[model samples]
Target: MTGLRIIFMGTPEFACPTLRTLIERGENVVAVVTQPDRPKGRGQQTLPPPVKVLAEQHGITVLQPVKVRLPESIEQIRALEPDLIVVVAFGQILPKALLDIPKHGCINVHASLLPRYRGAAPLNWCIINGETETGVTTMMMDVGLDTGDMLLKSATPIDPDEDTQSLHDRMSQLGAELLAQTLDRLVAGELTPEKQDDALTCYAPMMKKEDGLIDWTRSAQDINNQVRGMTPWPGAFSFLDDKLLKVYKVQTASGAGNPGEVVAAGRDGIEVACGEGSLLIRELQLEGKKRMSAGDFLAGYKVPAGALLGKKDGAVGA
Candidate 1:
């Protein structure tokens, strides 16, 4: 419990809080295993993973293996003498060789309740699916993808207006807190593993840019969910007169018009009709233009009353 040689495996910013919590609690984090640095941003400069940066700050040893299943990678992890490996958004399916090296095996801190939204993009899909509540699950890892037995779970409600960015930040801290509880229970020998019901499984595949395309035929609430889910990346968009109109925020309204028709365009908001109901678009970005309020956009760009969306596949943002 006190001197457990732990190896922390994770990548993105979502993974940082758990690692930070482990260190803050004085857990024996001997090494950090994160994905390799790669080109990012418009400059395409190679940058380290958020986990690596955090680990280095605390002077913990860091490891970046292209493929965790490779011989060298396996050997490196094996030599760490890890009693347990705590993985969070590690971005790789660890092989059994590495998983078996640790005395207590690997434990994953996932972002969703097991058997539901289990896959690469659970955070994004949970919102897109309009789930009412979701939470963190710490599970004993196996060869399968998020198919491992669950050790602990903590649930929280999803806010109606919550975007992925805001929800992600909230859940990152939530996962950290839940993981601390899990580790303590594990150390106390009070943890019980629960098998997930396959009958309740739902896969949340990785998001695509095309997935953000707003289908006017869908209800306003559904489109609103899509907008929330894709926020800050692969953002929800509609074609505005052959141009990409990125929709950042929207509120459901009660007006009536043909789907995609502009109910009204003004300083307050751009009211657009949906299949079932209308939407008050509060914020958006035109192609090759900066994101702005609907009022500001309307002040400059031309969005007439009868203008249609989804007319064609508009150009992608520069």
Candidate 2:
């Protein structure tokens, strides 16, 4: 319903597109609920979510609740009397009370085809697990995490080197499109929500900084996926010459040697050994150095052939 009163719930950059799309389509967004600002970045500076900033720019009422369970927050939402509540990467587990506030109930724009990859960080896990195809789903929200009934789903193929950041950007736009179409069908009483088969559910737990450490013993492809999937935050790292060396980009290779051994070094990429396969590092950065090509790193530092990457009692590169 283009003119339907809606409450949009989201927090990250991925969610911003859906919120923007609703406003652009002239939907009656009564309020926007997002997570509270938290300290972020190297300096731990407090930062508001992109969605919050965008909402403020549009003069939309913004609510940053540390927790939505509080009575006043509940009352505030009830006051709006919204027809539907839309959630997208809201970064919080919504309570049952809030899920039932909207007359048509709350719906979520999830990044994966539901019943598979049903948890936080679906986009990253999909590539990490080598899935060739993934997509977006609009679902009826339940108390369980992403275990909702699917209203509409749209699929897309994943490129061999597609990372989480790029995939997220694409899904954000796709989710907005799906939500719009889902809403149209819903208003026309043509929407059919299919219950997700719980037996087929897979989880995508949140990624942690420790998860980015490179495990050289793993397959070259797995390490490569981890490196790219964790990019731009909690980057995959390995110890080089007793110092932390972060790997920003990498590719699989055919060579093999002792796991973590530097097989070759050049401007193209740094070839490193794995248990069964090997990986060529394209980009890297030393602990206190600017990001540069792996070849540049090779030129400055002696990461010569046969040098081991990770040592015991040393930091493990994810």
Clashes of each: 0, 6
TM-score of 1: 0.97
Alpha-carbon shift of residue 77 in model 1 (angstroms): 0.4
Any runs in candidate 2 off by more than 4 Å, and if so which?
Answer: 311-318
Tens-place lDDT per residue, model 1, 52-136, is 9999999999999999899999999889899999999999998988889999889999999998988999989999999999999
Candidate 2 per-residue lDDT, tens place, 176-246, comes to 99999999988898988899898998999998888887888889988988887787666788887778888
In the order shown, what is each candidate's alpha-carbon RMSD?
Answer: 2.3, 1.5
Clashes counted in candidate 1 amount to 0
- For each candidate, give its TM-score against the true structure: 0.97, 0.96
